[model samples]
Target chain A: MYLAKIHITHKASILDPQGEAIKNALHRLDYQDVSNITAGKYFETTLTSDSKEQAEATTRSICESLLANQNMETFLFTVEKVED
Target chain B: MYLAKIHITHKASILDPQGEAIKNALHRLDYQDVSNITAGKYFETTLTSDSKEQAEATTRSICESLLANQNMETFLFTVEKVED
Candidate 1:
């Protein structure tokens, strides 16, 4: 089995209003040292793949087709072997 | 400068409907090998702190007070120094 740890985030050029809101809330709560914040989606996925390369390919395909919006978001993931 | 990479996930016992929906979608898309999936929130936060310990403490506090619900969710984070 393989485990894919994925993170999908907004492109750098896009405005992340949710992240901005969180930063603002932190400031109000006296966490003034927080300089910048960006929010994203995290996924822990387990799949049955024959090899690490196959796992990575499957993960990438899934992200591109479903998990991430190609126009506004970017995704990165690491695929690791796991004992069943 | 310090960077805090945080992940907030639902508790193990919680029913994650969103994750279930994603898994179903993937199955329909012919990713039958996908066995399990969990979704969470990811944050990349930058803060000005003198030490790694301080940064970790601040990040923990932020997760406890704002990012995670103690009853239904849990969080983990790593604090590392970064080039300014």
Candidate 2:
């Protein structure tokens, strides 16, 4: 088995309301020393496939189809085999 | 400087619509071998604090105040010093 972890985030040039909200809250909570609290989405999937190539392909397909909104967001992923 | 990485996810007993949608999409994309695509939120904060304790305390305060909805979601975080 393999584990595929994916992260999706807004494009650098785009405004991220969720991220901004978090940053504001951090400041209000006396965390003034912290800044730029960017928020994103993370996804984890367990692929029951036998081959790494198969798992990668499957993960890629999923990312393109629904895991991300390619128009406004960018996605990056890592695939690793599950240790017994 | 330090980096605070926070992840927030729905409680196990709660229904995660985003996760379910991603799981279904994976199957539709011919990734039938993949299952349980759970989704969550990830936040990264760069702290300019000089002390680890200060950073930790600030991060905890932010998490409780707004980083997560304590009633429906659980949050876990890791704080690491950044290498120059």
Runs in model 2 with CA error above 4 Å?
A: none
TM-scores for all candidates?
A: 0.97, 0.85
Give the per-prediction TM-score of chain B. Answer: 0.96, 0.90
Candidate 1 chain B minimal-lDDT segment of 10 residues: B49-58
* C-alpha-based local distance difference test score of model 2: 0.83
True contacts kept of 1: 0.92
lDDT of 1 by residue, B1-84 (tens): 999999999999999999999999999999987899999999999999888998999999999999999999999999999999
TM-score of 1: 0.97
Pairs in steric clash, model 2 = none
Put down candidate 2 lDDT per residue, B1-84, tens digits, no spaces: 889888888888889898888778667766778867778988888888888888887788788788778888888888989964
